[model samples]
Target chain A: MGTGYSIRRVERQDYEGVLQALSALTTVGSVSRTQFEETVDHWNHVKVSSEPEILQYHPYVVLHGEEVAATGMLFIERKLIHGCGLVGHIEDIAVSLHHQGKQLGRALIDHLTNLGLRHCYKVILDCDERNVRFYEKCGYSRAGVEMQRR
Target chain B: MGTGYSIRRVERQDYEGVLQALSALTTVGSVSRTQFEETVDHWNHVKVSSEPEILQYHPYVVLHGEEVAATGMLFIERKLIHGCGLVGHIEDIAVSLHHQGKQLGRALIDHLTNLGLRHCYKVILDCDERNVRFYEKCGYSRAGVEMQRR
Candidate 1:
């Protein structure tokens, strides 16, 4: 099915949508129901309190006619040492299965890229090995081997 | 002056130290004080209140005697679809000017890397163009040309 979507920063009222997406994402990733609910609640509280503009710094989800299909985060950028350093990073990205075949994934990325440029961030994110093609299609070429050891 | 130094995981009480670092870094990048403090506070609280099992996920500064000279973070990784994706990303990092020369930065990074491994998380981070050399020295080689427009 073709996906119809609109994405924007999440407001406090959108917390339920964020929760719903997390609940539906039984997508082979490691997650704890308790922790997921806790994280979602924390995000929602941050939006409601507005004590800190922290909510503005992260990414939100996509609404497919009232459904949360995907989610991502943007590390609100800042130039360091007088623009001689890297600024922002985008991470924690996911698009739901139904919307995967559609262009929403690339679109969300494009939206973030434009947003990053508008804000003038220096460095951006590089995808993991598995998602390289997905990001490449979004014009995100590899920066280098993202080596991780645990 | 010799750059006396130290490194350790962050504590909730060290909230002020992290805030001071963020304040000193105002010109380093585009960041607002109120918004940033809130974000820092969130990290502090999580580190303080996280479950012991999860506490392995937080990294902090190594004080050169009594000051918060450097900082780092740890993550618990997993490849969960629609979950955390089981990877850890290090963000909002900094070092004190007085401690730049010493290998405190490398030590801090290594410490977090070790921590990540312990928690089964694959640690990853993005470095600015200027600090690429710095991270390289820490054993985090370039992944590729990380370019972000927005």
Candidate 2:
């Protein structure tokens, strides 16, 4: 809600900027511009498909002036339960260190969660224990244990 | 594997059985047989699309003498990071009470996990604290906190 700050779906041109923002969250190794564009094109194609809205991916970025300051992704998954309802999986939220404290992260999360709630029965996410309080403040609560195998 | 027991992709005819298995996880309201068939067709259509393997959904079930004994789902999500790699989300793993203690759950999990690893960089899931040990025994470890808003 700040002046000169806006949140929108990520574009192909925002590849580098989006990756830069995501780097604040985890290691994002070198990605060629072509690869990024291809991935963007893939997302676009799926968005236009007539298939059911299962597996829809929406990656968003917050821009402060002309710089990408925050990024997050929401993946909508269709489930057989709940009358074949959609479930949103929010992931990879990151805010650039330089843009921290501007409430950009909170705004971006609100934007994504709102988008999710519009189309999903529930929005869910996984975060480190240290960030539980942050997400809890974002209107989420501890629901279950996260398990992984790499 | 027990005699007459086998795991494979869920078919349209397995709708009632699949929902019955999922009921052990949560409340699954009544879903019409036609709705289930339509959803199965949509999934099959997406699986055969030329689009990048971003939103592939695979639901599998273990059958014992033609009765669905266990069920699970693996959703592969395409990520911009990790070289645009795929991340597998395993969900709704359930076994009928009559079929419990026969290692059917473990076998179904292994089958789904193996399918995930073949196409994804990592496989992730969420389970209740009571089920942590079970998933751990199936080769998963606690990774993060699961948060949700319904």
Q: What is the C-alpha RMSD of each candidate to the true structure, in Å?
A: 6.7, 2.2
Q: Say which candidate scores most in lDDT.
A: 2
Each model's fraction of native contacts: 0.44, 0.78
Q: Write the per-residue lDDT of candidate 2 for residues A18-130, one digit (tens) a residue.
A: 88988888878778898788767666555412453433778888988879999988877777888877789999899998888888878977888998898788999998999
| Tens digit of per-residue lDDT, candidate 1, span A36-125 | 555545444332124223332456678888777777665542222342233456755667666666776677777766665554445467
What tens-digit string does per-residue lDDT give for candidate 1 at B6-110?
566666556556655644544544444554454445444432124443531365777877787766565332232444444565655676666666776677777
Q: What digit string (tens of lDDT, one per residue) describes model 2 on residues B50-110?
A: 4533337888899998899989888877777777777899988888877889998889889
Give DockQ: model 1: 0.30
Worst 10 residues of 2 chain A by lDDT: A46-55
DockQ of 2: 0.78
The TM-score, computed over Cα atoms with residue i paired to residue i, of candidate 1 is 0.57
**Residue A133 lDDT in model 2?**
94
Cα displacement (Å) at residue B74, model 1: 5.3
